[model samples]
Target: MNTRSGLFAVAVGALTALGLACGGAESVDELPPEPPENEVNFPALVQGVVNGWTINTSEEFPPIGCGAGSLINQMRCVGGNCDDVGAYCASAGATFSDTYWTSYFSEEGTNYRTCSAGWWMTGLVCRGAHCDDISIQCTQVTNRGTGSCRWADRQFSEEFPNTYSLPSGWYARGLACTGGLCDNLRVYECQLL
Candidate 1:
């Protein structure tokens, strides 16, 4: 190989070794920008680690709740029928972590559930009736300051650039869906960060 080609190969190898290659690992630029510090809700979700909970895939939702030390962050429907509800648990005071898709093939067929640490389940972006192509939007939370927030019943939608954003004085907490197909994306709201 030419000298220039050899040097290019060495550079590529070095980048791959350091997890900087195209698909090796995400670099800083690939990561979502950090949300404003004062913003109680965030859309910067990453893939979260599984906490080893047996996800229910039945027609009814299993009694899945956040652990004692963890807070309810992301809430959405999962399981084969989408009849089951699940929530992501985050350690208290955690700003935001990552989310992962847990898949299961039950009697109803293939299904998935989204989980994350310290995330505020925003909403889902689906393609059609099957809703298989699910994109979850979430907002993370933390208890850095001394203030309380409440869940509001008001609804909002596709407002922000990528996902939903709340109006002034409102924030997102989690999401809720109804019916077997989860055709609707309901935004859970909160006020006063």
Candidate 2:
């Protein structure tokens, strides 16, 4: 009878231990505080840049066409330079020119080849007030046949060692500087074009 009572006590103790282990002492009041009001919206904070590939595959270089010889044979180039056989040629050329080529290379299957003969405008923002000249470099990998623009970390200037406020109604579009004053400030006043 004493042994039976001991066994019952042990079972109750085990159950109590299990219950305490499962139900921790945490309360609802211990949660983290809410975020501040002035913070930027989550969508805007993680918004993708519009400057990436605006276009992809074109009619001339249909997706999955194989190349022939020096010219873009059968296969349609997708992403790079159109001039380069292995780059993304679809979005590298001008919209009008790409459209023309799309019509010109109108073929059915994986038998015909499209050739890029003229100069395709490399979608590179040139060094100017509207571009960060310091962050200017060309990527070796041609999309179709042209090299893509990349940001090279060649420091152009380090003159003013302080936070300079942008002019009223002007946001930083681009930044370029040489020796002394970091003057070239490309400002965009919410103009979309």
C-alpha lDDT score of every prediction, in listed order: 0.35, 0.21
- Residue 182 error, candidate 2, Å: 9.6
Clashes of each: 6, 22
TM-score per candidate, chains pooled: 0.29, 0.16
Off by over 4 Å in 1: 1-118, 122-165
Summed over model 1, clashes come to 6
lDDT of 2: 0.21
For residues 142-164, write the lDDT of model 1, one tens digit per residue.
54322323333432222212123
- Assess candidate 1 and give its lDDT: 0.35
The Cα RMSD of model 1 versus the native structure comes to 16.8
Model 2 TM-score (2 dp): 0.16
